[model samples]
Target: MADILLTAVINKFVEIGGNLLFQGGGDLYWFKDDIDWLQREMRHIRAYIDDAKDKATGGDLRVKNLLKDIQELAGDAEDLLDEFLPKFQQSNKCKGAICREFAMQIEKIKKRVDDIDHVRKTYNIIDTSNNNNDCIPLDRRRLFLYAGETEVIGLDDDFNMLQDKLLDQDLPYGVVSIVGMPGLGKTTLAKKLYRHVRDQFECSGLVYVSQQPREREILLDIAKQVGVTEEERKDNLEDNLKSLLKKKRYVILLDDIWDVEIWDYLKLYLPECDSKIGSRIILTSRNSNIGRYVGGGTSLHVLQPLDSKNSFELFTDKIFHFDNNDWANASPNLVNIGRDIVGRCGGIPLAIVVTAGMLRARERTEHAWKRVLERMGHKIHDGCAKVLALSYNDLPIASRPCFLYFGLYPEDHEIRAFDLKNMWIAEKLIVVNSGNRREAEDLAEDVLYDLISRNLIQVAKRTYNGRISSCRIHDLLHSL
Candidate 1:
C-alpha cells in the first residue's frame, strides 16, 4: 500500500528531476542552483521514504499518513514543472523570464520539502537504509539452478535423460519439446538443460515464444543472437536469420510455446538439417498438441509431477529447511500434520513450494500447520488461487501491480515484452530506479524478471540475443 504510492512518487520525482537537469539545457540553466538543490534534497528524502515503506508494511498509521503527505508533496513538485516547463518553452527569449516566473514557486517547492523534513523528524522516522527485503534478487543465468538447489526434488533422472538427448550427435539438428500441465516445471527443466548444453555450441540463445507469436520480432532476435546484423529494414528477416545460421552450429531454447504455428514460423529461420552439426532447438509447451505438431514422433518429453518420496523431501525441506534435529524432535502429531499437508500438495512442485513459503512465514506450531493443511483441500479441491495468493502476498508491495497486470490479458494469451513495457509505462505502474539512465522499458523488463524469479510468471519466449520476447501468465494467476 503506502509503500507502493511512495515508490511511485519517488520514481516520478526522479524522472522529473532527470528531465530538468539533462533535457532542460540552456533554456533553464540559470536555475542550476534550484535544480541541484531539488535533486540533492530528493535524494536525501529517498532514504526516509524507503524506511517508512518498511515500517508502513507493518500497518503503522502514522507512517502511512506521512507517506501520503510525501506523495502529495512530490505531486506538487511535478505539477510545478509540468506547468512551468511547457510555458517557458513556448515563450520567446524565455530563459530570464522563466527564471523570474518560477521564482515564487521555487520557494513554495523548498517550503514543501522543509515541511516534509519536519514531518520526517517529528515522526522520528529513522532511515534504516535497508532495501526491499521481499524481493529476492535473481541472476537470470542461474535461475533454474537456484530453484533446483532450493525447491526442486527428484528430477535427477529427468535431468539426465534430457541432457543425454540434447548431447546426442545423432539428432544434431532437430526439435526437442517438453510437454506437461501447468506447475510441472517444464520451463525450469528446459532452462537448466539449455544452460548446461549451450556452451558446447558455436552460438546459443534462448527465446520465449508464447501463444501469440510475433514472427518478425522473434526472427530478428534469433538473427541478432546468431550474429546477424540488420537495419530498420524488415523485408527479409526470416531469410536473413536463416542465412546467418545456415553455416553455424547453434542451439536455441524456446519456452512456453503454445502453438505449432509459432515453431513453424521460427523454423523458417532455424536450420533443421543433418548438415548442421551440434545445432538443436529445444522448447517447452503446456499443450500436448503443440508437442505432436512440432516433433511428430518420440521427440516430446512429457513432464511428470513429483512422486511421493520426492514430494515429502521437497515439503519437509521447505518447512524445516533441512534441520534434521528439528524434524527429529517434532511430535508424532506434528509429523502427521506435515505428511497430510504434503499429501494435499498432490505431488505438484508449485503447490508444495507455495504452501511451504506460507507456513514458513507463520508460527511453527502443529495447530498452525494443520489449519493450513485443512484449508488446502486434496487434489483439484485445492484451489490453485489460494496457493498463488500466498506467493503473491510474499511479493514486495512495489512489485504487485507488475504481477497483477498479467490478469488484464485473456486466458492463454501470449504477452510481448515490448508491448508490456509500454503498457506498464502508460498505466504508470513501474517505479524508476534513481540515477538509472536506462529507458523506462528497461526498468519494466527488470520488474518482469523479478516476477519471473519469484515464479509468478513464466518466460514464454525470448529473442536469440537473450532478451525476453514474450511472457505467459499462469492460468491460475489469471484467476487471481
Candidate 2:
C-alpha cells in the first residue's frame, strides 16, 4: 500500500506540473492555483505517510485507520484526475462542465486533507521525530560510511586467535581468512585485526574484492596504501606490487573475495616467501572454499554469533546508548524483556545492533521495550525485517524514494552501478550538478555506498578497479 500509494501520489504531481495545462496559458488560468494548492497539501500528507509506515504496520490501530483514510482520499484524487485532466487539457477554455467538476473535487480533496490533519494532530499520530539519520543525504554526499564502525563487542577470542596468526613470526607468508554468514562480524573482525597489527608490518593495504573486482585498481590501491617508492612506481602493477610486498613484509586485507579468480590475479604479485617478516593477508567471505583456496585452510577464526551472555551484553550497550543510566536503574522490568529481544537476535551482531536501533527510538520503559520484543516474534530474520523497516523509517526524507526504487528490480538481481545512477537521474531522484552527468554519477555512487554501510543492501559485485560494479539486497530486505 505504501509503495503503490506513494508512486501514484508523487507521480501524479509530476505529471500535473509537466502536462499541457501546467504550461504558461494554464498558469494564468485553469488548474494552476488549485492544482498547486492540492500538490502542496498532498506533499505534507505524503511526508506523514512516509513517516507513518512503521506505525501503520506495527500494530498501531490508530495509524492503520488513518492510513486507510489517506489511501481512500488518494484514490479519489487519482480517479477524479483521471477523468478531469484529459478533458481539461483537450479544451482551451474553462467555461465547461469538466472545469466545475475538477474544481469541486479538488476542494473536496482539500477539505478531507484538512480534516485528516486535524484528527492526526488531535490523536498525536503525526510523526514528531526531528532526528535524521545520516545514511544518505542527497544534497551532501558522503563517500565512506564504513569507517570507524569497527567498535565491536564480544570478539575478544576471535581477535586474539587472528592476532596470534598475523603476529606469528614463525608462520610463513600466507592468507588468514574469516568465514561466516552475512551480517556476522567477518568484516568487522578483519578490520579489528588489521588495526591491531598494521603497525607491526613494514607496510599495509586493504581493499574489498567484491565478486568482480578490477585487478588494476586492487593492485593500485594496495600499492598506494603500502607506500610504493619512486623505483617501484616506475614499473607496472605486477612488478611494482611484487617488488614492494615480497621485499617489505606487508599486511594486506582482501574483504569479501568471492572467486579464487581474484586470488589467481593477486597471486601473480604476492609470492610465497620465508616466515621471517611474518607478512599476512586477511580475507572475509561466506564461502569457506575461498579460504581453503587462498591459504590451504589455515585460518583459525570463522566468526560465530556472540554467545547468550554476550548477546545480552551487546544489546544492553546499544539500548543504553539511547537511554540514560537512571532509566536503566528504574526499568528493572526490562531485563527479561531485553533478554527476550536478544534471543530474537539469534546471536548475529548486525541483528543485535539493528534491534537495539529499534529500541533506541522509543522511551526506555516496559511498554516500549515489550512492544519491540513482541514485534520480534520467534525468528531472527523476522527481527531483521523489522531492522529494514526501522532503517527505512530512519532514512533521510529524500533518500526514501531512492531506497524504495530498489524494490522495482527483480529479487536477487545484480544492479549495475552506472545503470542505477542513470535511472535515478532520469527519475529526478538525483539532482545533476548543472546538468553535469559526471557529478550526478558520483552522487549516485555515494548513495549506494551509504545504503550498503547501513546493511540495508549488499554488494553483489565490484568493478576490477575497486568500485561498486553491481549491488543487491538480501531476500529479507527485498521481501520488504
Candidate 3:
C-alpha cells in the first residue's frame, strides 16, 4: 500500500505544481523547484516498492509492517499538501516570511522521504522486474458483477426466503437485516432481494451507510432519490423526506450499516405507510447486534459460507468463465490443484473470486498451479482481511488510499457523498483538471465510481438523478 501511496503523492505533487503554474504568478515560482524535488524523492521511494506489493501479500509480518510505516508517511505528505493548496490558491503572491516558511516545510518533507529511503535500503528489499502478472488490472476495467442468470448454488433458497420476508405484504413496515462475516455474500443477497421487490413499492432505493455516516447528507440523498426536487430539498431534509414518503409504499435497502445510531437517524425519515400499503427497510450488517437493534420483530438472516462442493463450483466457474463444461478440458492434476486452492479460501465468495482471478493468468500446469498453492498457504488461512488484501493490492496505487480511507469509518457506517468528496479533495487525492472545488468534487465522484466499478465499494443510496448518494466499504475491506 505504501508503494501505492508514494505513487499517489508523486502524482499529486505534479498536479499541485501544474495548478500553481496556471496562476502564472512570480511568487509561486518558489514552489516549482520544491515540487520537482518531491517528485524526484518519490521516484527514489518507488524503487524499493517494485516488489513490495508482492512481498507484503506474502504474509511476511516484517514486510507488511514496513509498508504500513511508508503508508503513514505518505499520508502525512498528502495532508501537508492539502493544507498547502488552499493557502497557495488564496495568495499566489507569497509574503517574504511565508515564502521562507513554505520552503522550510518542503525541506522537511524531503528529509522525511530520504529517511524512508534509507530504511528501505537497510531492509535489503530487492526490486523485482516482473510486471507480467496479468491476472487483473488494478482498476475499474476488471470490475466483476454477478449476472442475474448466474447460479449462486446454495443462495437460491436464502434468496427466496429473503424475498418472502421483503414481499410479505402482511406487515405495514419492518426492518430485516442479513448478518454475516465479511465476504459471506450479505450484500449480494440483499442486492438480489432489492432487485426482486424494488418495483413492488411506490418508491425504492438502496442506501449504503458506512462506518462514518453523515446523517443529514444521507437523509438528503434519500429524499432526493425518493423524488424530492432540488428546489424542495433545502432545510429540514429529514422532515421533507418523511412527508414525501408518508403516504407511499416504499422499500429502502440500507447496506453495510455499522452502528444503530445511523439507523436511529434514518428511520425517522422513512415513514411507516398505512396498513394497506406495506413499506419495508432492508439492511445488511456484519454485526448481529445491529440486526437485533433494528429487527423490529422478525428474526435476522445469518448467511453461512458455501459448502465445499459449492466453493469448488464457484472457483471453477470464475476461473473457467462460468463454462462448467470447460473443466473437463483441464488436466486432472490441475483439477486436483484447483480444489486444494478452493479449500484454502474457507468458502468466502470474495476469496474465491480473488483467488480464482489470481490463478486465471497463471500457466495451467500442475507445477505452476502448485506454486500458487504454495503462495496461497502463506496467508489463505489467516482471515478474510488477508484474502481481501489481494484485491487491495490489485488496486492501482492512486486508488488505494481512496479505498482504504473507507476503513476509517466504523463497521456498518454509510458515508455521505458530499463529505466523502470533500475529504478526498482536502487530502488532495482527487485530481481535477478544472482546478475549482465544484469540479474537483465531480472528479472525486468519478474516483468513487471507479471504486464502485471495481466492487471495492458499494452504493448505499442515490440521488434523484441517479448519482450515488451514499457508499459502503465491505467489512473485510474495512478491516484491511
Candidate 4:
C-alpha cells in the first residue's frame, strides 16, 4: 500500500516538476531548483516506502497513515502547480510578481516536504540509492457480456418452478410471466427456462419485444427464429404465423416487454388452439403491472434479488474466470473484502458481475481491493446503474422522495417497519383516502411494499402472518 502510494506521489511530483521546468515559457527558471529538489526527494523516499510496503499492506494502520500523509502532501504540491500554471500561461507584464507567487507556494510545499523527510530520517526509514521496485498500475473495465448470458446463481427454485409451468403438457395455451426490476435477471431466467423446455416443443422462437414495437419486423423475427422462412409466408405476417403455429406445439419467448399492447397485438398471431395443443408464451418484463396485464396475477413470477451466499458465489465466479482459464485462489482477507464489496451490489446479478469484472484486472492484494472498495459506489454505476436508473425514473412521484430517504441511513442497516411507515406518515408522503377511515400508516405501508415488490427495498424479516417486519434498502439502491 505504501509502495503504491509513494510511486503515485513520485510520478505526480515528476509530472509537476516537468511542467515547472519546461512548460512555463522559461520565465519560471528561478523556481526550477525547488521543483527539482521536490522531485528528487520524492524518488528517494520511494525506496524507503517500498521496503515497508508489505508491512503497511498487512493491516499496519500507522504505516498506511504515514504514506497517506505523503500522498496528500504531494497533492498539496500539485495544487500549488495548478495555481501557478495560469499565471505563466497569461501574457502578463509583471513576470516578477508571477515568480514571487510561485516562490511563495513552492516555499510552503518545501517546508512540508522537509518536515516529512525529517520524520523519515529520524525513524531510520532510509533506503539505498539503487533500490526500486516494479510499479504495477491500476486498471479499469472493458465491455463484457451481461449477466443474462453468464452462469446464474440464486435462482434454483425459480428455475424449477418456472420449468414445471413451461413443460406441463396438461396445461393449456399458457403464458408464464417473469417480472422484476431491471438487471434482476428476468431475461436470463426466461432464456434459461426456454433452453430447458424448447427441446420438448416441435418449434421455438425467442423474440425480443423492445419498448418500441414494430409489427412487421417482430413477425419476421419470430418466423426466422422458429424456422419459418420469409419464403413460406405467402399470406400476411399475422395469419401466416397463426397458421404455422397452430399446426405445431411451440414455445415462444418474448423478452423485455414494455407495453401490454405489444402482447395484445401479438397474441392473435399465436395459435388459438386449446390447451391440448401445448403451445406456450414466456414473457420477461421489468413492469409487474404488464406481467399481470398479459399473463394474469397467477401467471406472474416475481424474481427476488440473490441471497448473500449465492450472490458471493456469482461475484467470485466473475472475478476469477478469465480467457487464460486461470481461476484466482482468493486469500481469506481478500475474500472478506470481496464479501463486503459484493454486499454493496444488493444481490443484483448484473451489478455483482460488473463489479467483479472491474476488480478482476486489479492486483489481488488487500490495498488493491480496498482501493476499489472505497470508490465502489461510482464504479458500480458504470454498467449496472443505468438499469437501476430505469427503475428509479419509473418510480411514482410520491415514492421517489421516500425512496431517496433510504440513502441517508448507513448501507444495509435494517429499519423497523413501523418506524419507517410512521416517518413517511409524518412527512405526509402517504396520501390518505378521505372516504376510508384507515390510518395513513396503511397507505405508507403500501409505499414500502411497492418498493419491495419493485425489488428496490428488501424485506428483512416478516411477522407471524408474513407481513413485513423489518426492511432494508440495498447499498446500490442506497447510492441512487
Candidate 5:
C-alpha cells in the first residue's frame, strides 16, 4: 500500500509537473516534499564531484576521466531539475512576483559562478577589477523621466545660473558648483540645464564620476562625450583630451566628483581660455566646503529641500500615481497618516520614491496606513541606508573598511582624497604593492567612486589645482 502510494505520487508529478497539485486542494504538501528530494539529490551529486576531485589529486588519468564523466552527468541532472522544479512546484499564479524572485536568485547564482570562474582563471585575485572600467556612459540624448514635466515642478533656478556661466563667452574660466544633499535632485537639475543649453556651447559634455572616480575612466568618458574616437583614446589619454577640448567653448559637467585629484588632472586638459573665449565647469556636491573649494564663491548654487506642498506632491505622484483625487478623497485619518509618513522622508526624492513604492503596493485602508506609519522609522532607515549599503556590499571585502571609514567624517563634511587615502594606509585599510602605494590608493579611490556612483556620497567641487577638494553625505542619508 505504501509503495502504491509512492508510485501514484511520482506518476502524478511526472504527468502534470505538479501544476495541478494544488488545484484540487488534495495533499499538496507532497509537491514541496518532492522538490526537496530533488534538491537533496543535487547536493549528493555535488558531494560526489568533491570526492572525485579529492581522490584524483594523484593525477590518476583513468580516475580523472571517470570523474569528468560523472561530473557531466551530475551537471545535466542538476540542469534538468533546475528547468523543471519551478514549473512543477513553485507558485506560477503571479508572474511578476515569481519572475522577480527567480531573477534575484538567478542573479545570486550568476555572481557566485562568475566569482568562482574568475578564481579558476586567475592565480591571484587582485582588487583592481573593482574599478569603474566596466562603467558605461548613459545616453545623453535620451530624456530621463525622473525629472518629470517642467510645468509640474518648477525649474531649479540654478539651471539658469549655470546656463549664464556656460554661455558667457567673455568669462575666461568659470566653475559653477551645485551644492545639495543626496536625492535633493542635483543630478536632475544638472541634466535639465544640460538638456536646455547643451547646444549653445561649441562643445558640451557630462560625465557621472561615481564614488570610485577613476582619472583614466573620467578622461575616457570625456573623450567619448566629445566624440573622441576609440583610436584617439588608444593614444595618450591626456593628450587626446587636450587636443579635443582646446580653444573650443566647452561646457563640461563633472557629476558626483569625490577626489580633488580628478579636478587637478582634468584642469590640465581644459584650455586656459582668455576673457574673449569662455569655458565653464559645473559640478554638484553635497558639501558646502566642496562648493567653496571648487567654485571659489563665484558660481555656487545651494539646493534646499522642497516645501510641504512640493514634498506632498512628489510623494503623491509616486504612491497614488499622480491620482491626487484618490488621495484627497481617502479617509482623513488615512491621509494624515500618509502625510506623516511622507514628512519623515525629509523631502529626499529617492527616499520618497522608495517609500512611496512600498505604499503603492499596499491597500489604501486605515489599518494599512497605520501599519506603514508604525514602521515608518525603520522603513526610512532601510530606504536610505540600504541604497548605500548595496554598493558597500558589492565591494570586495578587502576594500569594505575603506568605505566604512567614511563614517568617521561628520555629516556634510568635505573629504579630501589625499588625506583620506593616507589615513586608510595608516589604519591598514589599504594594501601596498612593490614599494608603490599608488595601486592601493587607486583602489581606495575606486571604492569612493563606487559610493558616489551609488548616490551615497556627493562630489563637492574641484580646487584650482584640479583635485576633488571635498565631499559630503546628505544629512538624512548620513543619518542612516
Candidate 6:
C-alpha cells in the first residue's frame, strides 16, 4: 500500500508537471523541475524505508524517522500546490498554468496514498505462493467518440445491413450511402458502425465533414485520420486524399455530404478495389437524390426515427442505466410523465437522449416531467421550432439572430456556401476587411458549422463533391 501510494504521488507530480509545461505556453518549466526534485527525494526515502524493513535488526527508529520526514515533505509539497493553484486560477492569464500545476499536485498525493494501501495489502497477504497481487491487470483505456446528447436506437437492421455491405468483398461499388432526415441518427449510425468494424479493417477513419464542405477541410481531415502530420504546405485536396488512400484498405466515413460535385471529386480520389484489398467509403445525407447519385443506383439505407417502445427504452437506459429497474417503485407518476415526454419526442433518439440527460440530475417528480413533456409537445408542433426557440432564448442576445437566419431554408434544403456568406454580409452580422469575400464566406461557414456541431442545427446533406447543401432543426430543437 505504501509503495502504491508513493507511485501514485509520483505519477500525479509527473502529470501536473507535463500539463503545466504544455498548457502554460511552455512558461512553467520551473514547476516541472520542482516536481522532479520532489519525486527523486521521495524515491530515495522510500528505498531507505524498504531496506530498513528488509533488515529487521535495530533499524525501527531509523525507519520511523525516515517515514516522518517523507510525510512532512509530501504535506509541504501539497500545501505549496494548494496555495499556488488558487492564485493561478484567480489570475486570468495564469489560469491554465495554475490548473495544470494543481491537478498534477493532487494526482501525486493520491498516488502516494494508493501506494501505502497497496503495501499494507501485500504485507497482510497470508499465502506467499498465491501472489496474484503482482499480476495486476493493465487498465484498458478506450477511444470514445462522444456524440453529444445523441442516441442511436432501433436501427439494428439498418446498422447490420450497412455492416454487411462494408464487409462484402464482391460489392461492385466501394461507396455506400446512409440517407436520412436531419436529426435521424445518420451520423450516429455511422459512428456505431465505425466502432464495430474499426478493428476489422486495416485502418479506419471517421471524418466529421459537418462544416461547409471545403475541399481543403475534407483533405486535411482525411490526412489526419490516415496519420499525416505535416502542415502549411499547399496541395490539391484530391491529390492529398489519393495519396492517403494508396495501398490502404481503409473505411472513409464522409458525414453530411451536400453537393454532387463533392462526389465527382471524391470518386476520382478513391482507389479501385481488387480481390485482396478494397477501400470503402460511407456517406450520410438528407437528400435521397444525392444519395442515389453517389450510390450509383445502389440501394440507399434510410434511417427512421425510433419507435415508442425503443424511444422509452433508450430514455430509460440513459437515466437509469440498469440500476433503477423498478421504475414503478421510485415515483411511478414521474415514470409515466417521462414516458409521455419520450413519446412527444416523436421517436427521435437525439431528443430523447438530451431530454433524459437534462432530467437525470433533477428530482424525480410528476410536476417536473409534466412540464418537460408539455414543452416538448409544444415544440413538436413546428418540427423543432419551439425547441430551437427555447435554445435561442437561452443564448446571449448577440447569437439569437445569427441562429434564426439559419431557418429560412425548408427542411432538408441545403443552404449554399456563397449564399450563406452573402446573407451574413448583408445582415451585417460578420465583420469584414480588405473586401476578401472568400475569407468572409469561410468565417460565415465556420459560424454555421459551430452552431450545427452544438446541436442547434442538424447537418442534413453532403455531396461527394464536397458541399453542405442543406440543414434542418430537430423537431424539439426547432421549437427553441
Model 5: per-residue lDDT, tens digit, 133-179? 65655633123423453432433455676677656655434777776
Q: Output candidate 6 Cα RMSD.
A: 19.3
Tens-digit lDDT string for candidate 4 (1-480): 233333444444455455424555565555556767876876676556643444554677766666777878756765666677667757432277777777777788778778877867655565733333444222111011122454558898999999887666654448888998777888778888887788988998887766555767778888877777576765566677777888888888888777778888887788652467778889887777777877678778888889999998888678767644333465778779989998888788988888888887888789999999899866656777556765765566446657777776788899989888777555444535342326566777878887876667778999999999998987667775
Instruction: For candidate 6, write residues 141-230 as lDDT tens digits.
Output: 102234443345688888889999877887657767887555567777887887778777777677655324456666676666776545
RMSD of each: 14.4, 13.5, 15.9, 18.0, 20.2, 19.3
User: What is candidate 4's local distance difference test score?
Assistant: 0.71
Q: Point to the candidate with the largest TM-score.
A: 4
RMSD of 2: 13.5
Per-candidate TM equals 0.48, 0.50, 0.52, 0.60, 0.51, 0.48
Query: Which tens-of-lDDT digit does each residue in 1-480 have in candidate 2?
Result: 454454455556665666555676652255677777777777677676755666766778887888889888877877887777666666655655666766778788889989989877766665433434435222100112137755678988878888887777665446687875566777778888887788988888888776446788778877888888656765676687787676787888888776678888888887563456567888887666678777765663567668899988888788777446734485567777888878766677878887788777777778987877766644435545642454565556556667888889987788987788788767656654255668877887877776765456677888899888888865445655
Candidate 6 local accuracy as lDDT?
0.60
Identify the runs in model 6 with alpha carbons over 4 angstroms from their true place: 1-151, 228-241, 273-276, 321-328, 379-480
List where candidate 5 sits over 4 angstroms from the true fold: 1-155, 161-172, 273-275, 322-328, 386-479
Candidate 6 C-alpha error for residue 387, in Å? 10
Give the TM-score comparing model 4 with the true structure, all chains together. Answer: 0.60
How would you encode candidate 3's per-residue C-alpha lDDT over 1-480 as one tens digit per residue?
Answer: 565467668768767666745456477876787787877777666665746656766777777777777778787887777776677677667677766777788788777777766767776776533244435333321122223433465588899888887776663347677877667787777877887788888888766665456688678767777888786787666667788788788888787776679888777767653356678888887666677778743648878778899898888788888455667788888888889888767667878877787777776789988988888745443445553454455555566668767867887699998899888777666766556778877778877876765456777999999989898875445544
Cα displacement (Å) at residue 441, model 2: 49
- What's the TM for model 2? 0.50
